[model samples]
Target: MSIIIIGAGEVGYNVARKLSQERKDIIVIDKDEEKVERVAETLDVQAIHGSGSSISVLKEAGIERAEILIAATNSDEVNMVSCLVAGVQAIVPVKIARIRDPEYASNEKILGKEKLDIDLVINTDQEMVNSLLRILDIPGARDVVDFAEGRIRIASFMVEPGNPVAGKSLAELRKDYSNLELVVVAIYRDHRVIIPRGKDRLKERDLVYVLGESAAISQFLASFRDRKGVAPPTKVMIFGGGNVSLLLAKALEERGVATKVIEPDIERCQYLAQQLDKAIVLKGDFTSHDLLEEEHVREMDAFIALTEDEDRNILLALLAKTMGARRVIASINRVSFAPLAYQTGVDVVVSPPLLAVNRILQYIRKGKILNVAILPEEQAEVIETVAMETSDIIERPLKDLKLPSGILIGAILREGQVIIPRGESVILPGDKVTLVASSAAIPQLEKFLMVKLEYW
Candidate 1:
């Protein structure tokens, strides 16, 4: 399928890069000549320098016969306008636009079919907010993704020395914790991906990926935690007064958690003070030891750095951890800096680009894919799709399902219940099946999940 992508920013560039790697027919449009040149040099795809919303630009990018158009320019207006123009000028089946402004994203009438005709809208800030909330909910989890309307959650955690499950094999883990139902989907060891087996042992510092029922996943994590009976956090401090911090403050306040926000700009701090009821807005640079000490940052349960500056966020987060904060979270947007942030030994690093890209690619994926979550480093994917009644694989038992080599059925959600699939388990028509598969197995999965029209 042919696809046209507007802009060469992180989100758009990443989407194009992945699609191009898959050998899809991709054409990228951007007004910046340098960006287009960079993409053209980096990936084997066509790049045009022009306004994405211009009808002439669309025609130049072959929008008429394109299967998808992604308006992902940094500017919300440009992205939305491009989608609108694509809707009017082309027969693109899928029009996905990246919109960051809450004003435009929160309103349905503005993006409805009668208005922008956008098939999907991706809001990076909102997606980051959701990620922050989930990470806060599951302390010690570096990343979390939900499926089947949150009945199942896949989480990533780093194994630490002296943890009970650190050196255990998959078989031993099952035998020891049979009461807790969870699956170890993938293991990231020394930056390498390993699909676990019954004999493979988990080592300290290994980034472990687990999937299961929300509550069960929490229960299973107890074995590897070194909390010493300490709870997560009731009081949290966040640095910056940006949109992400605003949304997080609102959520934390609603939960009655004592929250504090530190922003360098007094005007921004004042704005936050007026917007948040329960959270305190402090004016100071968190990088200063005197300011952090004066504000009693050491006493806070958790400290989060949410500023747009990646380097500043890392510095402040490291300072917080050094000052005895129980947990520290930092936001890092650049993919190149992600590993460096992790190496800094911060409690958690949230990448907004990865979060946004995963959400956007779900639209382009084949099948009745309910949700698509790609793991860090593109090692594997945790996919959840609704099983169709007429699909050939639905009525068979789990053990007999002809899955690809790297694929594994992690869980099944039927109605409101969570099922840890056993060999005898059978998937019914309405069940949401969650699977964990390597990158090589995705095409096979897409074909399997997509119901052929000729089947009837």
Candidate 2:
């Protein structure tokens, strides 16, 4: 299938790069010639310089035969128009748009197929805020991905120095704790990805991806934590009164977590104070040492830096950690800065573009797959796809199936039941299978599990 992405911004660029790696027929459209050149030069995909919302541009970009049309331009109107034309006029099977405006998010009828026929609308701010809270809710977890409607969760935890599971083989842990069935799907050590074997040892500081029941995963994560003596986050400080911070504070307040926000803009601070009932809104520069000290940043259980500026965010996040904040997270918009941000003192780094990309990709691969969560390093991917009747793996036990080398079935959802997969588990036609594997195995798994995944 052919895919046309409108916008060479972070979100579109990433989606193009990923789909290109899968060797799909991909074309990117951008009004800016520089962006088109950059995408054409860096990524192995065709790039066209034109306005995506224009019918002439779509025709020129081969939207007539394209299967998926992603409109991720900065302007909401452009994206909406592009999708409306693609779905209604051009008949593109999948239409995804990264919508940033909060005002446009409401009014379902307008976004519905009856009006715009937009298949999926991704609110970047909302997705980013939700991801931030998901990571923050679970302490010591670098990444937390929920599936099966929150029944199952796949969490990535850093094996710290004093972790009980550190230096232990998977076989030993499973043998010792028979009831603990949380499956270790993949391990990342020193920037290398390992589809772990039973005999493989978990080294200190290794990032372990475990999947199972939410409660089981949570309890299992406890074994990998050296933070038993440390207090859980109660009072949280957020720098930036942007939409994400506002939404996060509202969520935290509803959960009864004491939250405080610091924004330099006086008008934004006033708006935040007006909207938030209980959360404290402080007007000051969060990057200032004096401001942090006067606000007692050391007493904060968690510090989240979500300013628009990445450099400032990195600085404030480091300052928050140095000032004794128990947990620190920073928002890095650029994909290039993700590794550097993680290497810094920040505990967790979230990218809004990446979060939006996941939702968009899920929609593109929908029905064939329910949803997908991608690792930043592109080392591993956890996907939820239903076992189709045409799938060869169906009607057979998992162990008996000839699966790929790096892929492991994490869970199966059948008849509203969540099953932690095992050797004896069988995959039925209608069952929803959650698989975790190296990025290299995703194409092969998707090809077999999804019906008629025709590629150009």
Candidate 3:
């Protein structure tokens, strides 16, 4: 599809780079000639200089030929107006607007597709918050990817020396917990994605990926938990009150998780205290070891560092890890700091640019089927698809069905029992089947599972 992206910022450039790799024709527009020229020179894309919201600028970029128009300028007004203009004048089939203002996000009537001309709205803050909380669920997991309406998940965690999973093999695990239905896909051992065979044993510091029902993943996690009471609703300790922290704290509280925020700014802390009830807000410098210790950092099930200063967040997250926090997550906006954060004791590292890239990628692919969600770290993809009544999936049992390789049907939420399929399992109309596919087959994953129905 011919794509035109506005704003030659890092987020815009990253989106163009990713889409260009897929061989899409991309054109980027930016007011600053320097950024436009720099991005065009570095990436395989066209550069158009002008304010993206201007009608003349849209026309010059061949918006009429563009299948998708993305307005991602930092300003919410620019993004919304640019997309509206593209929708009304350029006849673009899909228009995605990057909204930065948090207030506009809550006004669903204004941002909703039915009310606004925009087809999609991207919110990086909300996406990052979701990622932060998700990474905390599995104590040692560096990454978490949810599928099947969040019912099935794939998580990757490092097995340290004292970890329970460090000395176990898949076969032994199955023999010991025969009722549990979880599959280990790959292990990052000796710097490679080792396809674990039945005899392959988990070792210390090995990063392993496991796929299973959400409950099964929880059960598996329970085995490794240091001491389990009634599984606490993720007690989280955050080290900043920046936009990311505020958004994350609100999201956590909404999910019934306890959030404790430590910020040095008294005014921000007071604001947070007024805005959030489920979260405990504190005004103190988390960098001070005494302050962190007094706040009971070691008792926190999960610790996140989301301050604007990447160095501070990284340093504090590492400190929390050293102080015996089970999970440590840090938000590093700079790509350079990403490697360092991961190398340090921080368990999970999230980069805004990467999250923005994934969001834009989803916005561009609108014609295939129903909803699409790409898993973090490019590990997996979860798509909600409707199986056609005439499709082969309806006639034969799943075992007899010649399903695509590297793809497994995790669950069939047909009228809601969440059936973990057996050999005789069959798909019917209105049945929502959750599938897990490895990275290699993600592009063609949906093709093998559902037949896209089109109207005349």
Candidate 4:
């Protein structure tokens, strides 16, 4: 596919890098020659220097033959205009733009994606809030990747000493729960990945990668704790009153979760206070240890550092964890510190650029399978696909089914429980499944599972 991305920022660069790896003809355009050159040098793709919305620039970037046009510059106006110009022709299968403003988000008419000539509208801040909430929904989980029509999920969680799976073996767990179809793919023992062999045993403090329905992930976690009804809805403490924090606080409040926010700037704090009634807004510097203690950081269920400074965010999150917070999430826009944060026990680390790229890919390809991810320094990917409707496996019991190698169902939310399909499991209608597979295998995987049925 000929994919042209306008803008050489983090989102654009990430999209270009991913598409290029699939051996697609990729081209990137930007006004900054230095930024354009930098991306062009790092990724195996073409680049042009100019205003992305300009007709001359679009033409030079080969929009005529491009199958996908993505406008992801920092400015919403530029993205809208660029996509509009691309939409003039129906040849492009996907035309996506990044919409950053929350105010514009409320007015769908002014930026009603359909009216804007953009096939997909990506809102990074909102996506981050949604993603964070998903993590919070399932307490004690380190990472949650949904796949397989939303029925299946791969959740990574550390086994606590008092947890149910603390001393259980994979075979033993299965024997006990015969009705469940869960698989153990990889185990992180002492910061290492152990591709499971039947004889391996699960030990306490091990970070396990489990494959099951969304409910299974929760069920498995609950099994560990004493039948205490749902880890008391997390008492969330957020540091910073930026746009992202405001959205997060609103989202949390809607869910009836308690949220306390600390911001050093009086104006931002006042602005947040006026806009949000659900969360407790306080005018104080979160940097002060005295203030954090006074606010009961030690008693917080979760602490999120959303300040603009990456260094400060990491430091505060670490401190929160040290202070006995059960979970700590840091919003790190810089990609480089992701590994450091993870290693230091940061429960969840989110990056705006990474989130932006994933949102844009989802906007561009909604009906297709797209698993977006990044492995530290390496450029991440968005696997695009369409599930085949012709396969006999559709709606069939998973135990009686077989999936291609290198492909794992991340989630399958069918009616209710995100069934992490095990053997003997069945597929159902209207299930949103997320699959993780190599970029090369995505097309073949889609073809294999494509199901076709006869209808009256």
Best by TM-score: 1
- Per-residue CA lDDT of model 4 for 56-85, tens digit only, reads 888888888988888888898898888777
Go through the candidates in order and give the clash count of each: 0, 1, 0, 40
Model 1 spans with C-alpha error above 4 angstroms: 226-230, 451-456
Listed in order, each prediction's TM-score against the native is: 0.96, 0.94, 0.83, 0.82
How close to the true structure is residue 277 of candidate 4, measured as C-alpha lDDT? Answer: 86
Please give the lDDT score at residue 405 for candidate 4.
56
What would the per-residue lDDT of candidate 1 be over residues 83-132, giving only the tens digit for each residue? 88988887788888889898998778989887887888888888988888
Candidate number with the higher TM-score (2 or 3): 2
Best by lDDT: 1
TM-score of model 2 vs. true structure = 0.94
Tens digits of per-residue lDDT for model 3 on 213-302?
777777776787666522644688888888888888888888788789999999999998998878999888855798778878888888
CA-lDDT, candidates in order: 0.84, 0.82, 0.73, 0.71
Q: Give the range of the ten consecutive residues with the poorest summed lDDT in model 4.
A: 375-384
Worst 10 residues of 1 by lDDT: 447-456
Tell me how far candidate 2 lies from the true structure as C-alpha RMSD in angstroms.
2.4
Q: Of the candidates numbered 1 and 2, which has the greater TM-score value?
A: 1
